[model samples]
Target chain A: MKQNSLFLDRATIVSPHVNGWDEFLASLNCQDVISFEEDWRAQLESLPMRSRRRLSPQILLAISVAEKIHETLPKETAWVFASSVGEGETLNVILDALGTPEKAIQPLRFQNSVHNAASGQWTIAAGVKCPVTSINAHNYTVGAGFLKASMQIKSENCPVGLVLYDAPLPYPLSASHKINIPLGVGFALKPEPSANTIAELKISYCKTPNPMPFASLPQIPENSYNPILAVFPLLKCLAGSPQEDIFLGLNKDYGLCIKVKQL
Target chain B: MLQHPRTNNCGITHSSIVTCLGYGRSSHLLALREGRSGLSNNHGLDLQFDCYLGKVPDVEGIGFPSRVADFDNRATRLALAALVTDGFEQAVLKIRNRWGADRCGIVLGTSTSGVEMLEKTYKAIPENGAMPEDYSTRHHDNLHAITTFLQEYLGFTGPGYTISTACSSSAKALVDACQLVESGLCDAVLTGGVDSLCMTSLYGFESLELMSKVPCRPCDASRDGLSIGEAAAFMIVERDADGYLKLSGYGESSDGTSMSTPPPDGSGASQAIKAALERANLTPNDIDYVNLHGTATIVNDSTEAKAVETAVYRSVPASSVKGAIGHTLGAAGAAEAVFCQYALEDEVIPGNTGLIDLDPALLPNVSESCRNGQLRHVISNSFGFGGSNCALVLSR
Candidate 1:
């Protein structure tokens, strides 16, 4: 399984206004990429749902990116979806029903309660027949899902579509979790590499008494523009300024380091 | 043939294999073996009916971690108790060291992630959507709270993920773990499921008119509905050279028919079971026993029974442990699989405790009391919402 893996290519995220990958990266550094009024107004018209509050901006961003990346859909790629807070809107519906006896559980909301609802929705949207998988690993969700997708590609020798997205929770749930981060979504198209490739990823495990310090790992620069927020750093490193490796330090001081070298 | 590095990839391996050194739920077992119903009438449930429940007794001071705890939730406490038991601590440490905290991963399956906590938060939310400081962080929507707590406690780092596919969650977690190992992703994996009694789940089932007022009797002719209970069970899965119970085969299928309903003819479930048997390269007769996904719900039991009978091992002796544990939801599959391993080791088939007589309509291998015998292989079925089904084969 030492084949050189390629990211192939990805699509440009489309938003209601003009907020794209560059704008998103700029916003991370406290720059207003687009006016709030313009974005909100545009979102109001384009979204399927009526209410402004129901749609989290991050979810919109994620959906936009997903639509783009999946535009030239792979006929035979596996789908892996990762989420931290799953279907925040559905939670609100269930809670609202609990508050009202006459309301009764909405059949649609009930169906959306399963954790895999996002993947299901994506499958329908993408019209892909590949095996779809949804996974939640709390904060480490994206990493875990990525690991699974990577393994699938290696074992099955097929490309994989990895989508990670999380929406801000409904007020009470959102406020309680103390997760104030704006909505975010990331998608990666990973395929096994060919011979004589420049970059490679090797996942290894070592037992050590002290846990690895994850905070010390190099962070993606604040200025890099990428549709996928999570993998922006790796993308930047891959775009020419090659790093030998990027390490995701895990518990027990264990590290899953992705080693890369330019040929 | 292409010779890959064989990087000890995709499976578990270690100097000291983490194992389930002991099981302390025999007291619950003792009560079941004697036919004493763990189900009781409870008014605390928010549902309209005065239903029966298999509530853990005398758990007054069972405090969930305040950060993630909702006073009424029982799932977290149960998982903590299971993980803190005598051998569990050592096993956690051993796995942590063997795979390295960063390289170790935890995968859990659950139908409800602290829904009891969510219920409390729902009751207290202000009309304006304001919430108490800790309301959002409660364990309910933090799907990985348990895994996060476990990761921090045990210092495992590989990959932590949770799978929620209704009843088949834990079994699906096992499937995911095996894939992870087979793909050379992680060295060791901890896979299991947990669920607790909550108004949302209990009442949801009750509203569907699926809760049985009396004890649940799986594969019984007169069986009515399910008796919801709470439990958390985990197993350490590693690439082993001489593992006791090898996860020989697994197969998963999806029936897009409906979420809360079972597939009409059990065709989906049958496919999964047959696939597992075929993957293991063993005929149905090779399986000594079967742990059914017998939720006791009318459709579930009947459909599952038919599927098992149609499976390659049609005549193989089978029983649903739910009769004893009262349907532990997500934990049902993992818990029963562990029980199956024990049954294989002890050579005793625990009786279908609550089933007085086998249902004539449904054909399955049913029995009473523990039968002394050598069980070599077992197939466990777990079917969940949205027609998600998984079958796993564990061999001694």
Candidate 2:
């Protein structure tokens, strides 16, 4: 089958360590000290208290980046948001309220608990009637979001806005899967072809026929702790070049390899 | 093309596709026929609800590779179990070899993807901002875990995606898969869904007061709520061939009302079902059985029951399997569709296990156990959060 004719209009990343384009690019360095506290402060101050209570900093960062890249109102394009730690902070509040029977469940928090809450907020904020899909795929969360967006372009022949975001884990629960990096949000404005031409997105996957080339990269031992290091290859591929045919290989062993070309 | 040319040949054909090819539930037909329930009480720390779950029994005894163990979300295990058995591996291999991996694709749906792992991580994070060593490598964020797993297991290099629209996730996945095939994007597609028991889901449902304390009884007046279960169901959906069950039609619509509650009138669901029938070039009378998204929730049951009555032929037999296996969340659509296929193949309508007497005020097709009949064309409904609705029509 011929690959769908979809183009990446723009891609944006927002995190506590960076807000605008330049800062986001710089924070890609592993040494940067990105703090969720600082990021959340900036995000919370921008929204009204009511909206703040309903939308988390992670969601806000994602929407802000997506809105900037898409430039169009949310209503103009279909929305698909992907997340790993979805509304964990809000869930914490709900669990705490449940602990004390005197505290009735907060309707705002309750409404925000659904996985699609971020997409809903984006829809209302954008005032767009386009469909919104919210998905969660633990490790492949973003990749899955990208795939779905691609499929929509092929099957529905419509432009799609893809948003990927995750916040730092809340306390207690944070102890389970801890990350020191600041909250992260990535957005790609994917548009369908208007005319017969330009670059298109093509994705493929295959089973590993031979052993993977893990030996090429520096091994981090068997149980080393890393944060987004594995995905650096994919990010680098997307950010480093303006290429036509970008090949993202998520190994059968779950390792990822990215190759790009300018056609 | 806005609509594919092959749209007429796409749908959920059987009243139920019940094949006992995996580990979770044994004797799929026998269990439903005898009204046997598969849910057992789970005693995990994160799980707060004292309820029954339709968990795959004796899975721990199966020796999975350590690498596979590292990706230990219940969804992966269940999907692998289903794919490795029942000639699934051979089928996948055949397609990959013939079409090339890139020509084969995968579309899976699930409401939760290893959220239990997230829950575990959340409980471990300290205030100092140090994560566990395995957090980064964990496949928790990658929606492609299942796709990658299948890619590795089956060696397919095709497009892959994970649909997450609450309970309707997998049902919609199947619909998307059919569309992909009909559009000529792929010669074959792996469509299914998987979800496991987790604290986030349990508490989330319990907080809404939707979890039933006792076993679930769909269409019964005495039924109070739902029993949350865990499962993974998959189907190798290919283009219409000589022996394959032709996916005749599919329809999807969204209401955008509320995530937890469906539209009171079942308009969105009815629209999807009707659209599917229209796409299949069939009338309500052509449907032999209707497998409902009967979660047993008061509002869901009432609304879905009404939709089936209004949209389907009056004489079509309709029932919900939640009575026997509990609500499998993301896997419900594919799992139930499998049951519908089995009904068509076996020539029997498995009874609605736990319903002793249908609600007097509800529609008339509700019944207690499977009935012997010549089943052929069937419709399966899967409604999810955010008012996402999907209906599939399959024919033998």
Per-candidate TM-scores read: 0.78, 0.76
> Under CAPRI classification, how is model 1 graded?
acceptable
User: How much lDDT does candidate 1 score?
Assistant: 0.61
Q: Give the root-mean-square deviation of each candidate in angstroms.
A: 6.1, 6.0
Worst 10 residues of 2 chain B by lDDT: B12-21
Error of 1 at A181 (Å): 7.9
Model 1 C-alpha lDDT per residue in residues A1-263, reported as the tens digit of each score: 22334443442323333344455444333223222332342232323565334433444544555665564445666666666666665676677777776536655556556666655444444444344566776655545665666665664456666666554455555555443333344444555444423455454433322333333224434332221244434444544554545544333344345554444
- B382: Cα error in model 1, Å: 1.4
Docking class of 2: incorrect
Give the winner by DockQ: 1
DockQ of each: 0.26, 0.18
What is the TM-score of candidate 2?
0.76
Off by over 4 Å in 1: A1-78, A101-103, A120-132, A155-159, A177-228, A234-263, B1-25, B28-37, B42-46, B63-73, B94-103, B136-140, B180-187, B241-243, B356-361, B368-370
